[model samples]
Target chain A: MAKYYQPEFECMALEDMRALQSEKLVKQVKRVYENVKYYRDLMDAKGVTPDDIKSIDDIHKLPFLTKADLRDAYPYGLLGTDLKNCVRIQSTSGTTGRRVVAFYTQADVDMWEDCCARAVTAVGGTNEDVCQVAYGYGLFTGGPGLNGGSHKVGCLTLPMSSGNTERQIQFMRDLHATILCCTPSYAAYIGETLKEMGLTPDDIDLKAGIFGAEPWTEEMRRDIEKSLGIKAYDIYGLTETSGPGVSFECEEQTGMHINEDHFYAEIIDPETGEVLPEGSKGELVFTSLDKEGFPLLRYRTRDICVLSRKKCSCGRTLIKMSKPMGRSDDMLIIRGVNVFPSQIETVLIKEGYSPNYLIEVDRVKNNDTLDVSVELSPEQFSDTVKDLAIKEKALADAIKTMLGINPKVHLVAPKTITRSEGKAVRVIDKRKLHD
Target chain B: MSVKQISVFIENKKGELAAATRYLANHNINLRALSIADTQDFGILRIICDDPKATETVLREGGYISTVTDVLAAEIEDKPGSMAAILEVLAEAHVIVEYTYAFLAPDGHAYMIFRVDDNAVASAALAGAGIKTANQEDLF
Candidate 1:
């Protein structure tokens, strides 16, 4: 029964939240327009004058930023101010390409920790808790972001990078670590590994976990909680959005409350860039309020979701955004693996199989699983049918080794899969993974 | 008079070749004389080995449909006109050699494994050309 983490803001209304967003949005526009050249160019393209952006409604005049925008300006193109003024740098895993880097000044880093502290406090993490930051360290942001936040909340922080699973478990038991942070997928892996190793979560002192850096559903949350015997929460962020503190799930478990004090968020039609009404699903956009080194303006986050300014039960006067259902492109986030289904199709066709396939995503307990069904053409089917069961097992086994989750392979008749000549729906998620 | 030959299909893709070899490794089967005839999508892996049944089992286990076919093996000297001389005999006998691969025999002789248009006719032609045919025991 270790205790140190606590949720402070679980209930508050929409009016004061919008007021805070307006104040921050005003300061953010002035700061970014003066410092960041990228935002200036983007705004210029949209015919948006800095002064024209009078209110949060005028933010529609600015262009939306995207992962590609971040990628195109690889390494240092997105940097608003000088690297000298930047005190610390954090990045997302360059799983797709070069990692997105976010620079922070001493003040910016302090604000980030504050945001992280809000996350800590939202999840009820306190100073009496022994915090273990198990996100991979290095250029990746998840590690330092939570570490600093845990410290801010006055917790004893442990800077533990991921993959040393055995050592992490030992450290958890030895130090009586009550609070934890890491990617949701890796957390599930840890839970699975712990069970395989015959160690129960009660054997250690962990009571809560802050999982981010990858898209995870509420199903994974339930799975992590059951497997690790810990209360799991989702902390939303991107490297460009100040790591994991942009928003977080409060005690209500409805959605994450956007800490409008530090960031102004919007939901826009991803195609037209038109600002959508709150609660309408669209691409998420962000503009940092007090960020100094790299404040983005109207950055399109590709995360297709909705936002609300309703008061939460946690008493926080901030906007809350729904968990993203999917992305604009083929960003199928299977158990935190961000990959296009086309990539898997390419792999299958390269293996001399037909391109026709169906992806079934489901949850086993609290964890998510993927199953891929591929069809072999008639002639090849007979030759392969003798080995069909074997082929099915082998392909599933191979994909599991590659994608980190065992995707069951089903061999069906050609044209059995519903194929459209238009946009293909490659993934069929059958799991109650998202709340 | 008779030699063991197995047929395998390989896909044309980057690292697919290595993937196939890894599958073979998983089954612990060894490759002997191998010849590949490739099209754009797939290639046939013509192989001769000591354990054809075991190789077939492993290939099936690895999710590849494979088959065992009988072919001809002839002992030829490692000298000039060795290939031309043997083909000349086949051409005269009106036997077509579709594809071929070779291995050194245990008795300081080189054995050529051939898939012909007609195995029976080709075997008679090779024997008529004074070429001694090989047995499975001669494989090692």
Candidate 2:
């Protein structure tokens, strides 16, 4: 049986959690002030004492730690604790600048595994279920994170990393695996392969899928579920937040319950630094409470979403968050306006095509413009004369609904684009000003 | 003996394919038999073309991701029972097809290009069965 622990500290009435947060938060501030030079200097530079964070509500007064801050701190600068205690470190190859490495102690790993166990359990996974992990392993946090959690849940786990689709299917059928964890793109590929192989959903006993590590659409969810004959669930997290269990979809299927016990969530206006009220969309920020090796305070996760207090069908009393729309970094500034890749995605799916498209932002002269690229299905390829105008209108209407900005839609043939095995590249921003 | 087949990565979107097509069209290049393998994010546009060099030049100039590769094109009898015979030969020869697609040929035979399980063995097996397969010469 998989042992699970719901954070009692989080589910306690809102006031108690806040009280606990304030108390633990104070200790963290003092720990950083006394040991970590960067944070101490930051506080010194601001003329703020650790005692200034008097209440949990005073968190807004603290400076937000951006990815830039992480880069400036770099390597050992961010760690408040000693390197000796770190059991593991996971990171993304920081193509933007400095590689973002996060340290996890043994206790931190245990907690991460517990959270992942909750993710597996939330979707009705049990000891009897076979959890097949296909996310990339090693430096990438996805594979090992879920592997540990599946083991914690006592499920028969396959530590298969991504690729080798044929062998993947063979193992899937051979192990009689029930749960799948991988990127949404890989899931779709696996699903497509199963269909190509003439294997029915009944051919293998797949029950649930926990997909993440890349952004996907509801249409994609539908496609995956239909192909695999299973319920598809989204798991959310980044390497910085301990991989794919920062929040996860419950049986309710509305949104993810932000495990508010181990971590606290805040949504703030990216430009003004003003915290948004509940139900308002803003950049998500985090403050780790229980994390020991390298707990972060006000870590500005560029992911944008709205917080909700609405009670979930699932019994969990944790606060819910709308599925992360997209990252702030991925937000496009076209003609002096901001746009997100997900906005285009929503429109594309609603327009009834597989929401597979790319946004190319370029500066011709001093003005910025966007070129939206899409793939056309074989069904639509029958009539070049009639279908062209209809498909274009549908796509244009979708752009109007989602982006609040019009973009030129270019229709390409299906399979004309490169498929990313990891994170789907959504935008090719070539605006010289931004670069 | 060669026809050049180029694989271009494109998003499944409106105008994207046309842009690639128009670029090639402007260069007076023709797509002989093209197929796209699509997923949600992107698909690879595989093309056998009359002007592979010109097509690659145009595609690159148009800022598209493309690569040219060699693929075998086989002649299949365009009849109901022909496919069965083709598969039986491969089955006996212990050869596999990774992926395959068909195109109509002018002579009334179906030309199928296959990504084979074992390229050398499949080529030998098909030759042993006396099935006429198109090499690079037939492609151009």
Candidate 3:
């Protein structure tokens, strides 16, 4: 039987959940309009007021908060409550632009932890399990969020922030950790380490793994699952939305269940800001329904995905979101074709290649050139240059089939491609089209 | 008999081959024979060193991808037809030679290293033809 951290909310009736969201959305808008002057001015500029946001249905009237808005506001412009009430702050890695720092009050932290706890429970975690959080602890939301969630689920938590792979495996073996939480890439690395140490999945006690924070393919999920002998679950969240507990995968592994009571999600046409209907592939927008310290209404997430209200077997009524295709900022337009790094990754893993790849997009003579440098593993290494060339050509053909654009594949030595401890830097756009 | 030859993957960039050779020299590892097969993007540096195991370890520690493969090292006369005679025996035995490199041994003898598709057939054919082949310890 499926267990739940908060059954009342997770299994709430559809109508009751919508009613609850409407109630929370109305109160949240009023609070943000009154306390946050940055958003208040945006609302004023849009000629909308608290009275215009009567319920969740009227959310369209509110102004959208984007990364640019956050950058414009900087440190404290988006704070819905006084600084004295704020307890902690988590921040983005800021690889794209300026870092986005999100603040939280005591209540806000508790709410976020509750959402994470629900995610843990959905993954069959309980007090009997030993949960190891390998996500980076400080600044990054991945570690702290899952750490708190494990604590809330009454599990003996190991706050083993990323790296130190040997020690991670040591503790995992010594303590018989049952659940693992970290980015998908880190989990894959750990699995690789386990094999290198001559240890199999049977040597460890891990039963479930929650992997996210970066885009991963179904091929990668299967690879990790087989490597670790654990049912890998995908957890989705961003620091902009109070870390990684916003939505989490259930046993079904189809999509993640969003904590709709705390976060109201909408799919928007990224180009025109028009709200896309359910199941439409578009950019995702979120609203913190009850956050006090930093309450953002209609915050543009820039994650492209679809929202589905289709009935889930896990018995959670919270809407489900497909794994994000790719962040809008991470999408690369090469040779006038929309290409995502994740698409390239899917092809690489499917072709029995390591996910550690570097994509260099360059412009030469008014033409876009896609060059992929993939690390050749020991198993794939050939003594003859002809065989290696054939492998490279085959990989290039496979990528071309997937992307509809020819790519020059370079087979590099193993470990030549940098392994990421955090989010991996996969793409280097040398085109400089912005200039 | 066959000897272990370490093949290191080296990118075809300026100074990459020097860097790899320098890594071995820094470790005081001596190479008996070496050959490089290059493409536009990368090259495979195949070497017969005093200690194949140590050479592989040092190269790996230096962040070079390498693997050890068994290659037949047949002692051949310095005459022009000597190398062809060894290949003719293997060709008659239907054993294809993938690549070959010759080096002068310390004893003033020439030896040809043959990477073949079937090592067992090539080794047997060389033995049937009364050709002398070097083993792993014979080179050092």
Candidate 4:
């Protein structure tokens, strides 16, 4: 049977949910305009004000917030509530420039946890379950978000952060953890470790897994499910909004259902910022309807996906979002062709190689050169160099078919590509360094 | 009739060949005979080592993609056309040689390693021609 943590919000009627979102958005805009000078100035420059935002329909009248705006605001410029009211902060794992830091008030944290709780409940979590949160605990939001949500769901939450795979499995088996939460790569690693330790899915009591914080292919999802003997669910969120639990997959597993009551989602053409109609594939934009500490209006998520309002079998009236195709930031334009590492990954897994691989892009004499270094597993290794060359050419040809651009494929030694414990780093663009 | 040869895949980059050799040297593995086939991007380093199994294990532990294959190793004359005569015999037998390399033994005997399409046919043809071929034990 379908389950929900907050059935009232999860199964709310479309009209009622929109009414609630509009109410929250109006109050949120005014709160940001009055409290945040950065947003207030942006609103003035855009010729928008609190009075202009009468409802969610008027949200387009307000200016959109980008990562650049957050950078300009820095540490405290965008805080909507007083410092005394702010209780916690979570930071992004951004490697370039400045890391984004999001503040949260007590109420804001409660709301975020409630979103996560709904996600856990959707995956069949209950008070009888034990939840293991294996996402990194520190500044990364994955751990804390799921941890709080598991608590809210009354599951015996395992605060075990990421790493120490042996210990993770130890506790998982000893405590009979029913739900696991972490990035998709980590979940795969755990599954790999389980095999290395001669443990099978039957030995563990895990029933479900919540994997996110990075893009993963459907092939990876099936692989994880088979290895761990759990139905893997994808969760979507960003620190810009409130860690994870922005949206989560229900039993339907088609797409994640957005918590429409709290966050209003809009798909916009990334180039023009024009809002596209429902079911359109475009960049995702979110407005934290009632976040008190750092209320952002129309924050571009940079994730490309389509949203559907089709009636779901999960009995949730909330809209569903397809798994992000790729982040606009993660997309690489090489030789005038746009390529995502996830697309390359899908090809790799399909070709019977581990998802561990490296993509190197460089510019030579003004021409972009793409090199893909893939790890050769023992099963694929051959005695004849001619056979190996044929394998490499076949892989390169397959990738060229997928990307519409030829790439030099190098079959490296197995386990040479770095294993990701959190989000995998798959691309190294030498072109950027030269620029 | 045939001996085990370890072939390692190394990228066509500076020090990759040196790195593979250094790994073998570090593991105390000795190369009895070795040959390299190079292309634009990578090279296959084929070696008849003192210990084929140990060399493979060390190379794998060093994160090198390697595989072992059975290749006919026949003792040949040190003079010119020694390889051509062996090749002519194999050609007459219709045993296609994929790749071949030669090295001088410490005892002053020359040996040629021939990777053929069918090792058994090549070995029988070479034996029938009165040419002596080294087995895995004889190579060491």
In each prediction, how many residue pairs overlap at the backbone (N, C-alpha, C within less than 3 A)? Answer: 22, 24, 0, 0
Ten-residue segment with the worst summed lDDT in candidate 1 chain A?
A: A1-10
Task: Provide the DockQ value for model 4.
Answer: 0.32
How large is the i-RMS for each model, in angstroms?
8.0, 11.3, 1.1, 1.8
What lDDT score is found at residue A114 in candidate 3? 93
Q: List the candidates ranked by DockQ, beginning with the highest.
A: 3, 4, 2, 1
In the range A329-435, model 2's lDDT, one tens digit per residue, is: 86554542346677677677767667778889875432356788887754444211233556776787668555545677777755555789998887897743311
lDDT of 4 by residue, A275-332 (tens): 9999898999999999988888899988889999999998999999998875667766
Give the lowest summed-lDDT range of ten residues in model 1 chain B. Answer: B36-45
On a 0 to 1 DockQ scale, where is model 2?
Answer: 0.06
Instruction: Name the candidate, 3 or 4, with the larger lDDT value.
Output: 3
TM-score-superior candidate, 1 or 3: 1
By lDDT, rank the candidates, best first. Answer: 3, 4, 2, 1
Question: In candidate 1, residue A294 scores what lDDT?
Answer: 76
- Pitting candidate 2 against candidate 4, the one with the higher DockQ is 4
By summed lDDT, which 10 consecutive residues of candidate 4 chain B come out lowest? Answer: B131-140
Chain A TM-scores of each predicted structure, in the order given, are 0.77, 0.76, 0.78, 0.78
Worst 10 residues of 4 chain A by lDDT: A91-100
Please provide TM-scores, in order, for all candidate models, with all chains considered together: 0.66, 0.60, 0.61, 0.62
Model 1 spans > 4 angstroms off: A1-20, A95-98, A334-337, A340-420, A423-435, B1-6, B10-140
- Tell me the tens digit of each residue's lDDT in model 1 across A269-317: 8788778887899888888867887787777777888898776665665
